[model samples]
Target: MSLFPIFLKLTGRPCVVIGAGRLAESKIESLRAAEAAITVIAPRAIDAIAERADAGELILRARPYVEGDLAGAFLVVAATDDPAVNRAVFAEATASGVLCNAVDDPPFCDFYFPSVVRRGDLQLAISTAGNSPALAQQLRKELNEQLPLDLGDWLADLGNLRREVVTAEPLNESRRLLLHQLAQRHVCAYDQCPSRLLAREHARTNPIPMEKA
Candidate 1:
């Protein structure tokens, strides 16, 4: 299925998960990582979940999923092992126009969690469109190994330099070429030093004029 992939910022927003097992625990962790305020509804929860609830990390309702639980939720995850309960949760979420994800059920999910690799502020996500989650996870691991640990820092530096270049000079073919050259030359340097400073000095020396010869 063709899906429009989009990244969401859920910091401090309300999210609900209708299960307390391993799957629900995983979803809760992911939401917490995103800084979402999460509430879990299940008849019983694992020790970790119970602890989080007790610690006020999340709101845990030690009861079965109810129809009104979908109210005021920004996102919903139906992770119960019981198909009937999962279906009910999906239906309530759909009726409320909230985004829903039913674990292992693509048709019932409005969104699917991707396998992610996070480094500092850099995040890389991989998904198989809910087809093969294991493969997606494997690819994420492979990419984590292949990518350099310092790449994120380098990228952040390059991004700042790009913004400066764009603001310092108007957009034109010559300016574009200069930025491209600079990016290609310094995009691999993670540690900022006199070498990078010298490189920038040299790059600024020869600005190609936009006028045709």
Candidate 2:
């Protein structure tokens, strides 16, 4: 992939948005999901954006874009109706070494937002490298339907069992196998899981607590 894909920790980090229209509202929502400290700049905004500001979800500048609005920002979104405004936000953000996305303008964007399927902590992101966002959204919809709604709960349970196996088994191979089996619990025939017995046997044989992940 030309673009390196990685999840970022943006919680409480400073972020700036240059618009408050519909497109900008979507961008702000994405930032809010990551718990970023967002500041929106626009003379007028849609009711949703204004409501968010009133709710203290984000700060509203109530003005047009300024030359140094991008300073001290970790990331910026330029989603104004004016192309010139978007480009200006990108230029300022770039000069200040901050990552910026100029909405639908690929050349002005440092990164593109992916179509995401979020199930608790499990997030699957799909991108077409800005070629077709509609296709990405379509795939996301399909995956959301196929993936089990309670998959996150199952994963959490499996995690607890895997940690127990790590403490119980002396050899890495045995622990690995036990963890692997626990992962395959969903495929167990009938109502009983054969791997649970094996995991317990190993724990009974070697009772040693270990560090947790």
lDDT of 2 by residue, 52-143 (tens): 99999999999999899988999999989999999998888888899999999999989999999987778999999998999999999999
> Residue 78's C-alpha lDDT in candidate 1?
97
Worst 10 residues of 1 by lDDT: 186-195
What's the alpha carbon RMSD for model 1? Answer: 4.5
Candidate models: Cα lDDT each:
0.83, 0.86
**Estimated TM-score per prediction?**
0.79, 0.85
- lDDT (0-100) at residue 33 of candidate 2? 96
Residue 82, candidate 1: Cα error in Å is 1.2
Tens-digit lDDT track of model 1 for 64-177? 998899999999999999988988888998999999999988888999989998775688888899788999999999999988797778778777777655655555776677
TM-score of model number 2: 0.85
